[model samples]
Target: MGDHALALGTAWAGSVQAAGFIALPRRELTAALVERAGVLLDAASGTGDPAAAGAVGRWLVEAHFTHPSTLEHTLTVLGPALVRAGPDRGPAVLAALARGYAAALQERTRAEQERITAAAFVARTAAEQARWASEARFGALFADAAIGIAIVTAAGEIVEVNRALCEMFGRPADEVLHRSVDVYIPADDHEHRQTLRAMQAGELEHARLERPYAHAGGETIWTDIVLSLVRAPDGAPRFIVAMIADVTERHRLETSLRHQAEHDPLTGLPNRTLFFERLEAALEAGRHVGVCYLDVDDLKAVNDTLGHDVGDHVLQTLARRLAAEVGPGIGSGARAGAGGSGHLVARMAGDEFVVLVERPADRPDPAEPLRVAQRALDVVRRPVVSGPHRIVVSASVGVVEREDSASGSGELEKAADLMKAADTTLHWAKKDGRNRVARFDAERHRAAVARFELSARMPDALEAGEFVLDYQPLVRLTDQRLVGVEALVRWDPPGGDRIGPDVFIPLAEESGLIVPLGRWVLSEACRQGVRWREEHPDTQLFVSVNLAARQVREPGIVDVVASVLAESGWPAHALQLELTESDLMGTTGEPLDALPALAAMGVRIAIDDFGTGYSNLAYLRTLPVHALKLAGQFVTRPFATGMPDASGEDGHDGVDLEVLALLIELAHTLGLSVTAEVVETAVQLERLRKLGCDTGQGWYFAPPVPPAAVPALFSGPVGPT
Candidate 1:
């Protein structure tokens, strides 16, 4: 192989002058050709593989030995030398080398043909004889090329088309030639026309675009087209040459993939990605927009009871109905002169679906969203039959509408804010009642947002000691003596404003923060009680703290209470826990069982707000209850004026003195002490005292005071105002 490479390398060097445009020096070029010859010889003798020979052929093309005579000259000089070195394998090697050279030469020739076609426009400006010669040279490539080609005059008239172009359009050559380009390309295509105008005006040398063309067989063919402007030697625009490749199948695959990405598979509706895209586009356009967010109520129950198959069927059916009802407007309104703007119904994961409606900025309809929501609920309520079972479902809808004028700049709202508002309204609909439509209410939404913010800040507020206790006196009705104080917690933020328990207690309970917050309140109240006892040793004023229902149900509540009592050194007997009548009545199982243990620890259990709940007086006797604090209504109702009684008598109070008298008597019989709440006037205090109310607390005696103020009240018996 070494001796054969040297002889072949010498022959290759001899052919370099005829090969034309040799890029390398004589020594380097000789060495590269000798190495390639060695590889070919080795493969032919040992492995019998032709791939090595093919690689060498491609190397020659890359090394710029591109003249038509290069391959012929190479074979003529080296063929006999190779045959002499390896006679048995020499013929096979020669065949492989010829095939590789032809393949590479063909590819390079195709690329060069395209370049010469582009150069034809400039060449046509030469002498008439030279133009004819250039055309003759391009004619062979134009006739045999696989890609479609067309030559159009500057006025967009097709002067000629190659056989490939005619075949691409499924037409004969004469039928397509001499026709206006508009016969194939649509005149109404603005982008294509603009590109052509730019090229014809000498502003652009070339442009590439993908467009659809109509075939002779009445099918659309997607084509990747390259348009090159042929200009005169003076740079004046001449004819245009277009090279086109059919991309129909590739375009179809791309379209299918994009559809799968943007649409729900089961329902075939637009997914959240496409929905938000259209929403943001609408908002950016400054259109008045409406959104209806719908959630299928109890769809999970269908999946759990029947099967996921049925659940899928239900979702698909609902999606179809919503799209059919709402999408007709979408297509027509998307056009310029349509009556409406547009609408899009999309599936937003699981049982959630969202509908976006766009309206023109000149006309805004706030009630349109509500109507759409109602229509959605109506359609969803229709029964759907899947397999052998029929399923009925309802949807809760939240509707939001923003007027373009509201923003003063034609932009109605942001997409994110609109969606969030719609979601919040949907929650409101579900919360108010299922199968209902809830329109966005700014006031109610603001209050809910404020509650959420306050709830989120509660843990930090509690950690910072922002919570404080205010004592409301629980007085004795008989002697008008200050007997106890109900401990009420207040939120005093750094801003120096106090928030009452009514505003934040429910928030704490909903967020599960009440467990820790209640524990803190209990510990603080117990500590305050110990301080009061030390300040006034003679007075045995019990401190009453209201318990939230959530706190009562806590697993370690009894332990928490015991720990607080033991830590504060406050007597359990003097620390009263008040539970709302409803909370105590609802208590059962462990929560109810825990009550006795608390009572055993000497803590008094009183039912606060008595008669407000549907209480079984007989059931109250079974519990370890200490006292009943009559609901404020019972005290205020007897003296109430300007109200009708249950019997509808005008100016007669709802409850007279008799009802109050009977309530106090019933408490005595149950072995329960009674406390009359909200004692305001001297007359009411006298009436309660006459009714044998054991204790009372009202402004008539003294309003709730701080711990320091309580000692002053303890200095004397309190009298009615």
Candidate 2:
């Protein structure tokens, strides 16, 4: 019994410390607890005494183990301690001990309650005197409260009002007290009346909202109002308590901030963000949406000539004028023009603005956008006085309309795409002539997109080796002997048919991809030239590669040519570099210097598309010596005769043989060979030979063939040279 008591005391001390009961000395508390528990356990085990359990409970309460959990721990720990003390103790005895402990705890609770009731009885006698004073204090506080307070009866009549509520409503206490609550709310405010009815009917226990309150001064005061229900002891509804806090300043600030965010600061017009928001809203409502994308024509010139200050003034003035003419506030009462009240004019960005117009719901007119655009154009053409300068400006407008619900993208993206299409059409209007309105055309836009797609794919196509070269024979005009072949590039894109140079070459030049593409052509042509030279050693055929103007101006032209010749082991004399007439006519610097240097290295240079670009004969004579390939338009002019004579003694064909004769003679005088292009028939070939044309290239000789077909052409028969 002594050992079990000591162990139980130690365990109890540890558990109490763990439970944060650390006010007393641990050793004293543990020793006293163990002695008490041993005595209690002995009585309970020997006689099964309920008094022993009651004593244990009282001891627990005195030790300040008043927490239910602490009491539970005490009882739990005592169970084992009792078992240790009496080896024969059973569950029945433990149950009796639990019942006794619970009775003791209940009795302690009843005693505490009795003591509270006695204290309350004494307080009640004193509270009667304090109650009158507390009521007076409450009345004073209510009168002096910062927030407005009002008490209203269940019948919707104001029962009482504090000083703040009287001041808040600008009315005397007696005048406001008897009035209905409806005086504070407008009769047209059905929604507010419905809310009030719901609260009064017990449908709502409490309600809070920000609403405008009517002031006796004939102005509305915004307030954050809260209504709370008061109930009697039986839970029956009593008078309602209403509290109101003035929020007029906050509401004004919020409105001002929203205006600033949505409007352009300089022009006081809606900005792009708000314009897109309105567009999305209209689309969501499934309204027919139309927009006029307007651009200030030559506005950059105005900015450059005057200054940015003047430019800003011009934009602001223009914005005001456009708004007056095309916006909903135009003219007078009826919203002016066909736009009605469903229109928005916004400044998109620098030098660009847009006017959004929606068809009226009663009568939808598809042509209303055009009328809006015309009005905007008329307004833009008016002169604006900025500072001392009276600047006259014109604008171009592109209009597009959408009648279907938005698809393919979300609301914002669809609006963005619509604006983009409008901008594109606006560009077209500017291109045709500034200060005009243009409607979006599906075919033109589709063609433009196709061009963009082809241009986008050029670099990848080059990387994938989809580009290749085909050779067309440049034959001798006299005997039709194969003298040279012009190398033309073509794109054989994967999963698509062959794309011609006419399509992708110009695209390449525009995108500046021509530099590498031209390099590939030059290198590949030289490489193939070496193979042809080995096969046709006696023929002495040269390979020609046409060069774009940009490629000729590239910094490393001479080096590239030298590298290609060195790499291919092809003689430089057998490679001809063909340049367009404009390339050689007006050019200087790199091309002029590079051409002579290349000629000095024994590489021949020829002018392709001669008689085009109106080359200066005097200037042409100064370029390094070369052959002139006459443009195909000259020789292919509908030959009149079935056969043409080799001699020019008789003017046989309708072709201007006189001009051809003079051009050939001019070339010979300059010590240059002349090549005729498009010499298709025997008559044209005979006429070119008679005119002293040295070589000819046309479909009549052969269309451009693959490199594998070139060797076969070399073995074929040749006419007399």
- Prediction 1 TM-score vs. true: 0.74
Runs in model 2 with CA error above 4 Å?
1-144, 160-175, 214-220, 329-342, 403-413, 534-539, 553-571, 585-603, 638-655, 716-721
Model 2 root-mean-square deviation: 22.4
616-656: candidate 2 lDDT, tens digit per residue: 67756778858888888778653645443576443354446
Candidate 1 global lDDT? 0.79
**C-alpha RMSD by candidate, in order:** 15.9, 22.4
What TM-score does model 2 achieve against the real structure? 0.74
TM-score of each: 0.74, 0.74
| lDDT of candidate 1 over 1-721, digit per residue (tens) | 4887777776786686656768788889888888887787676665546577767767777787655466567766655555554544554566566556556655664575477565454354344522544566578778877678888888888887888888888999888888888777697788998998888788988898889989999999988787888776576877788888665644553464356557777799998888999889877887778999999999999999999999999999999999887654433234322566446889998999998877878887666677778878888999999989989999999988765223344333678777878899899999998899988777677788889999999999999999888788887877778888898888989976888888999899999988889999899999988988888789888989988888887778899999999999999998889998677756442226678999999999999999887567777767888899999988887877644457765343435668888888988998899998888777677778878899988787777666677777786678543
lDDT agreement of model 2 with the native: 0.75
